[model samples]
Every structure is written in C-alpha cells, then in structure tokens.
Target: MTTTSPHPSRTTSPPHLEVTWTDPVTGRKGYVVIDRLVRGVASGGLRMREGCTLDEVRGLAAGMTRKEALHYDPGNRYIPLGGAKGGIDCSPHDPAADAVLGRFLEAVGALLKHHWTTGEDLGLRQDTLDRVLAGLGVESSVEAVYPLLEDPAGARRRLADAFAVDVDGIPLPDLVGGLGVAESALTALDRLGIPRTSARAVVQGFGSMGGATARYLARAGVRVVALVDALGVVANPDGLDVEELLRTRDALGGIDRSRLRPGDTEADGDTWLDVECEVLVPAAVSYCVHPRDQARITARVIAEAANMPVLPEAEAALHARGVLVLPDFVANSATNAWWWWTLFGDIGADATEAERKVRDAMRRLTSDMLVRAENLGITPREAALVVVDRRLAAIEERFGGPGAHAAARREGSRP
Candidate 1:
C-alpha cells in the first residue's frame, strides 16, 4: 500500500482507532477520525484531497462533538452518531484519487453496521459522495438523521436540513460556522462602535457558507462592496449588486470575469480581502490572507467564517495591529447548534424557538468571552481559556465533584 504521511498534529504514537482502510493493489489510504461516539453511532464527512491527514480528521471529529452540544443540548441528550471524519489523500482531478475514494468508501462501508454515516467536504463533492455511498450500499445516513430543528438565521432549520441532506449523499452545511462568524463580526463591530447597519463589508467565497453570510449581512444592512470565488474577485464602489452577482456566480463560487475590467482590481480570488470596507469576511478556504497579505487588509474587523482560515501567527499579528481578531472556535458556534436541533427536533419549541436558543447560546458565548477579554485586558483567545476553565469547573461540580451541582440555573448566569 502507498504510505501516507503521518498526521502533523499527532506525535510518534497516540491512539488506535477501529476504523481504517488501505488498499494494497492500488496502494491507497483512507481514514476515519472518530472523535466521540456518544449515542452508539458516529457520523461526519469524508474529505478527499492530496494532503488529507489523520490529525486533521481527528480535530474535525472532535469539533463535531462540540457542534453536537450546540445543537442537541438538553432534549437531544444522547449525541447519537459519535463524531468522525474520513479523509482520502487524493485531489479531485486525479483518476487514482477517485478510485481510491471508491475503494475506501467500500472498505469503510464494510463496517457500516456500526451506524457510521458520511458527508461531503474538501475534495469530496456531493456527486462523489453518492458514487461512494451507492457502491457501498450504505443506508440510514446522517443527513437524513438530522432532526428538523429551527434555525436562528431565519433560514435556520432549513439551513440545517439543507446541510444535513446529502446532496447526492454528501452533507456540506456550515450554517453554524457562519452564525458564529456573524456573532464575532457583531462583537467586533460593537467593539469598534460601528452599527451593523452602518458597516460596509466584503465577503469572500461563494459556497453556501459565504453566500448565506453575505445575504445575512446585506439583510442586516451591511453593504458588501465586493465578493470573490475560486475563479476571481469583484468590486463595485456603488455597492456590488449581490443578487446580480449571485445570478452570474457558478456553482463552484465563480464570478464571470468576462465582464471585468482589470488593473483597478488587486487580485481576483483574493479581491474580497482587499476591499475598502470596515469588515472583511473570509468565509472560504484557509490562509486566504497570510502574514504577507495582512498589511493589505483594509477591514478593521476580520471575521473568520471558515475554520482556522488564518494562520496562528498571522492571527496574532492581526491582534497586535489593533485589528480585532475573532477566533474561529468562538465565532463558529453553529456547528453544535445545528447538529443538536437536527437530531432531536428541539423539544423546547418550534423552529423559531430553536433558533432563539441558538442565538442566545451564541450571544452569551461571544459576549461573555469578549467581556472577559475586556476585563482581563487580554485577547479573546486568552479570555476563552478563562471561560473554558470556569466551564470545566462547572462540569466537574455537576458530573464529578463530590458536591457536584449540575443543576440548571436561571437563564443568563454562570455557575
């Protein structure tokens, strides 16, 4: 079998997981990052890319566990599908990659009796997921299992439903991520003393995450001066017509460059980053703005809509420059929220009720973290550590301490 590179996040040895795949004939490797399997079953997406690794899968799986918390907090107690993420080190263009993916899915499907479900991410597209699931004859999928719950973004439940639905058996919902980003932006805006309605923003990425966020920001009266996709970026000082652009955007988040006049633009794909606006939303892929590009960022508040889109060093640099930095984990709370409601249908109330819950949860999370940062005179990340410490103490008291106090307190409280 072809030897895969070890996960960067892992040491020489860490843990042994049950699910693994390596085809000898083709020499390919596929893996599952089983983060947590609380309710018997574990579910997550399968990413296919040239450099996919076990370590990333591990982290993504764990993130799914936390995401479940945001969604299925109370009524949906048992996070049924323990979180897991699979990865194949084959980019979309490689024929060998597709073969590896199919075989890997079939190989992994052998254990589907364990209630393992899969979704789409990275190089794995919806159609590819279908091919894999179909060949493997896997049923009782995760997307179908996403319980109908209300969404806070007005399109909340549907967002969850849409994300959970395997567009050909591959789920790609990041509404939770988007919501968290908006929350972070809001926090930054409040910090900058800018009203949401008064802020002009630029959005990068036309995928569901970027598209939905841009629409929400516009709805909230944030003028998006520019937007970009894989093909290129676009700008309009008079306020780019989002609707018209969406009409022209391709499925891969492309903007028609045929209508563009060059020279006035900085870069196509990175256009949104250079927009002369108060806020910049990097809702697409990772490292769109690296350290070298940080100086070009015109936005006072850079809200990360994608996971760890900015490098850690760059993030620190941004903070030092007095640009408010919103950590991805804190900003992207929608994962757990969507996961929970999609599983249990929110016994608390209807979709609206469920949405309110998500907002309250996120608002509390962002606000509390920001408040802590302000109070301690530290970055939000540091303040998050404080929040985590207190939460751990609470968990210890409730579940482990001799005088454990897991009792629910009144709304809006700590301890």
Candidate 2:
C-alpha cells in the first residue's frame, strides 16, 4: 500500500511499499513498511509486541531513514540504504510467537530476497530470528543487500566474525548501539560543562542496549545510580554494580534479584523519572516520556537509546526546562552504521576498531547536532532532522532518488 498524502516529496511521501501479513495458522498480524528505497533495498529490524501496528512500523521505518541518512559520509564505503521496518502484533512470550514470526517471514520471503533486509528489534532476539531464517533455508536476514556488495562472501564473513567477537561477555553487535549512546551522553555532558566522573546516570532498561550503556558509563566513571527493568527499579546511591546486573539479566532483560548488592534498593518502576541523575537513558520502549512525565524528569540530559522514546511535546517541554535531549537518530545510530561499516569494509571485526569508529562518529555527530541546534535556536531533534534533510538531498543528487535503481532495472540498464 502507498500513502495518501497530496504533497509526496521524499520526506513527506508515503512509503514505497507497505505489506500487512496475517499468519495462516495463528491469525497473528505482522506489518512491513518501506519508507524509502535507496538502490532498490531498504534496511530495518523486525519487532514483535502485543499491539504492534502498521503506523508504529511506519514511524520506525521513517526513523530508520533518518538514522541511515544521519550517518552518511561522502568518503565512507557504507552508503546508507533506504528505511524499512517490520513488526508483528504478538507478544514475544506467546507460545505461537515463533510460529507467527516464521510464517510472516515466509510470507514476506520475496521482499526479503531483494528489497528488505532486517534483523532483531524490540521484543525479538537475533538468535531466534536467525534460527527461524535458517529453518526456512534463508541464508541470512541481510541477504537482500548481498547484491549491492563488492564482495558478498567477504562481507558476510566479516559480519559473522564481528558478531562472534564478544566484549566483556557481551556480543559485539549488542555493545555498539549502547557504545554510541554512551558517547552521545558523554558528549552532551561535556558540552554542558559537566565532567564525566561527576555525573550520575539512571538507565530505564536492563536489556542489551541499557545494560551495555550502563556498563560503559560506569567504566567511564559515571555513577550508574539506578536501573529499571520489567521487575522494577534497582538502585544504589553510590552506583550499582553494572557488570553484576548485566551478568544476571534474563533473556527478556529482567534483573535477577538474587544478584542485588546489600546497598541496592528496589522501587516501583514509575519512579525512574524521579531519580536524581545527570543523565537518563530511556533505552526500552517508545513514547515513554509524555508531557506529564517531562515535569518529573530531573536529569540534565536524556540520551534516547530506544527509538522515539520521548514524545515531541514532552521533548519541547523538556527543552523549555533546559533538558538536553540527544535525539535517537543521532545518539543510537551506531549499531546500524556499525553493521554496514563492518560489512562494507570501512571497519573490521575487531572490537577496538568498532569502538573507535562508533566513538569518533557519535562524538562528532552529537557535537555537530548540538551546534546546529544552538545556531538555529531549535531543539536537537530539529537540528538532526535538518542534517538528515541535507544529507538525504546530497545522497539523492549523487545516487538518484528512491526509484532510480528500479527504473534503471526496468529499462535494462545498470543503476
């Protein structure tokens, strides 16, 4: 399906394609939205949740566009792909969840073959998705982009090797996004004239992203005061044991109470906003911070590790109150960019290389965005959008528009 908007420019245009799939056996619904297509393929992740909708997937796909465009560098080997996202309307804990996912993948096999490349997202695990794909005889969730590779075999090997490499018992792929978040948070703190050693942080999730962010921030001398998960808030005024908490997390990100330290206290999850800290990382769900929630936030900066964590009005309110919101696209873009950088040979499978690239890029991007925001007298999200717009235009000018490749293929010509 396409959008009904009258003014269909690149940014305002409806998705290039949208598919709603219903699992035959379980009757579960799944959605795929391709917001834009660069070189005939779009990239995003597949999320499973209880009430996942097309509109949510569409928003995520659009965010993916901005995330991809925000990382565009003229000299980099990893040209940004278009934006796409898939979501299934079923809880990951449901007994039929895997079957629903398998059926959805089978239904969208054609798109996966050539147009949409995906991986894990909220409520989904990469290993589970990979297992499902393997059972379906699919080579990889990223197989759709293989045709664009200079050396598909080498690219595949590099990504596989990178995924196999673990840092502090966490896989490399899981650490990169949180690494970016930590860098973005640190940059924001630096810009605000705050020292990392003097700052405190409360992260609202203990999953892959939040766990990694807390670990890195603690290592960087930021006192990680609290962590909120499905259970509730785990707090330690003098800084929780981040590595212990990380080691004790379940697959679904819930903390194992058996591992809590004596000084740590548990509280209601909603009290996360009340935590006194210099940085708050909302690394779990989207639209978590509404207008009312904004007033409760005491943090100097909010680094969004989750996509669309803060509502626009809440962000505006926070901005009015001098809270710096490092936008999601700018702050949490490292994971997607890292995947491409490694696959395209801009970086290697080594942890140090990934760390260096993510740190450098995030610092630069956050600094640039903040500077732009100040110059334009706007919020950081607006500034990041401005950057995305300019980069997207440049990408289009050099590579042509979304349909360029398809048009070329139809005319029996190379794109």
Candidate 3:
C-alpha cells in the first residue's frame, strides 16, 4: 500500500517525514515524522507509546515549522528545512521494545548524512540511549555530546536547555519552553481580563517542560496549585511547594508515590484535566486527555506545553464548549527561539541579550496570535495555524515552484 498521506491540507506541509521499523520480537510496526529541517541538517526526539500514530507525528512535524520560523532570519525564510520524526507503539515492558528501537536507529541513521539527528523519547530512557549509542559506536556520553556541539546561544542547545537540562549553567535561565508557555498563558489570561496578581494555575507534568513552566509562572506571580510527576499526582489548593517536589523527582521524572500523597480530591488518571483553575497546562506524555475527560475540564484556558499533548478531536470538543486553547506550538516556542538565534543571529552578545531576544519573540508571537484570534473570529489554536500556514505558504514557493503554494492553499482551506 502506498503510505504517502493524501496530499496534506496545504501544498507544503513538507513531505511527511518518514522512518518506520517492525520489531522482530514483538511483531509491532512504528514510524517517525520529522518535519522542517532548516539548515543542511536537523534533529528531534522520538516518542514511543500506544496511540503514537503517524497523524500525531504529522501534527508535531507541522509545529516544527512554527518553531523554526520563530527565529526568522533574513535567509531562514528562504531556506527549506527537512523536518523528520519517528513514532512507535509499544509499552516499555514489551519484549520487542529494544529491538524495535535499535532497528529504527540503524534504518533512520541513513539520513545522518543529510543532517538528520534523532534522540530517545517516551518509553525510552537514558540507559536505552546508552545501549543504542554503544551499538552505533557513538563513543560519547550525554555529558560529552553537549560539549562537542554546545553553545550558550545556539538554537539547538538553548532548546535543549528549555527542556531543562542546562549545560554547565552557562545558559543561565535558558529555556524557551517556560518563557513561551508563561507568555502564552499570560496572554490567554489577559484576554479574559485576568490580572497577573490573581492568576492561579496547575501543571500536569513535572518533567522538564512542566517544571520550567511552573517555576516561570510562580515567578510571574501566578500561584501554582499542583505539580505532578509520573510517580503519582499531588495537589494542594493552598499551593504545592515546587522546591520540595523537585528534590524528589528522579532523572527519568518519576516521583516516588510511596513518600507522597495527592491532595486534589484524589481521582485516577485524567483527573488533572478536570482540576478547577484559570489555566490547565499538560506538559507530559500525549493523549493524557481523551474523550471521557473532555467535558470534565474546568479550566478557562488550556495551554499546551508538550508536543501534541491534546488530540485533535479532543481539542475540537473543548473548542465547542468554549474553552480557550493556547496551542502547544505557540506556548512552547522558546526551544525554537533559542535555536534560531544561535543558528541565524549575532550570538556573541551577553546572556541578557539572548534572553531578551527570546522573550521579545515570545511576546510578539503570542500577542499576535491572541489579537489575530480576536480579530479573525477564530479560536486561538486556529489562529496559530493561520500564522503558521501563511509562513508555510511563503516557504513552499521556494521549492520546485509556484504550483506547491496553490496546492497548499487549497489544502489549508479544507474544512
């Protein structure tokens, strides 16, 4: 069967980035969808889990365009980035998991010649990465890899920091993820006329992205009610202590449920979706919010800090009920901003200048999207795609010619 997606909704969704593998032990199949490789090369982390579909990966690849474009360069606008991603559907305990991941790296590694770099995600851990690297003769530790390619102001490195892994602390407070999320959440709240002093929020994932957002929000005067890691959810309407929780979270981000207790009206999975608050931030795994919990959502604004954390159908349901979604792409733009400045800007400035550039970009993008949504009479999420689509349309023209733009316009216009 021809696997090509029926031409994307727009002419230049950038050919569905592809990489697939079948596990010899488990007999399950998987693929990756990397989109928009801006320079001569590009890279992104791979996700492994159930519901890890190509469609989801496609949406993530689409977000990469918005990410890369945030760093708008005089030349970046004209250069076509080859975006790529990889996806797999298997639990970490599945016997075939190891083999599937190994085969994927071997097959996908072919693109390394073209600047395609891949990292582990979801069910995969640092040990799994060590094993994969050993097999590939990548005789470098995570500690070592950063130094070889590390730069305080480089876009890729800054993005990595936004995920909360600072390199030698040289990139003090370097995190586009938190900056963008805080900016968007603030924008969403401001539109509803919520004062900064009165804002209250909850973060579902206490991992890199979630943790950063919580810290930034707290700094902005928003009282965070809960910060849950993978161990188990915890809440305190009076406000959970961020400092204590970070001390307990393991590197893989699993918290010790044994030593903790959840205070937000104890409920099972998906409980975070219904928490009463002004903003809801899902920064962890995907599909955490589904059909059953869509209606239970009580937050006035939903900000996406993880990659495609909300399903498309679920998003539409929320829209129908009048919930504002700030979009994962728009909220988590710091990663892209950091990388773009590194790749295209005069990166020799002091740390403050780099950070200023990031904040300014976030402020501009989120403010523009929020204002456009109001003016265009569309949801914030829909307005995000409008800005993304317009830039994408302009980039599509640089390829094999003008027909691509026409095709993309028609696809984008689809209902």
Which model scores highest in TM-score? Answer: 2
Model 3: lDDT to the true structure: 0.61
Q: What TM-score, computed on C-alpha atoms, does each candidate reach?
A: 0.73, 0.96, 0.76
Model 3 lDDT tens row, 188-233: 7878888867777889877656776776777778878766666456
Reference-based lDDT, each prediction: 0.57, 0.89, 0.61
Q: Whose TM-score is higher: candidate 2's or candidate 3's? A: 2
Candidate 2 C-alpha lDDT tens digits along 227-249: 99997899998999999878878
- Of the candidates shown, which would achieve the greatest lDDT relative to the real structure? 2
Better of 2 and 3 by lDDT: 2
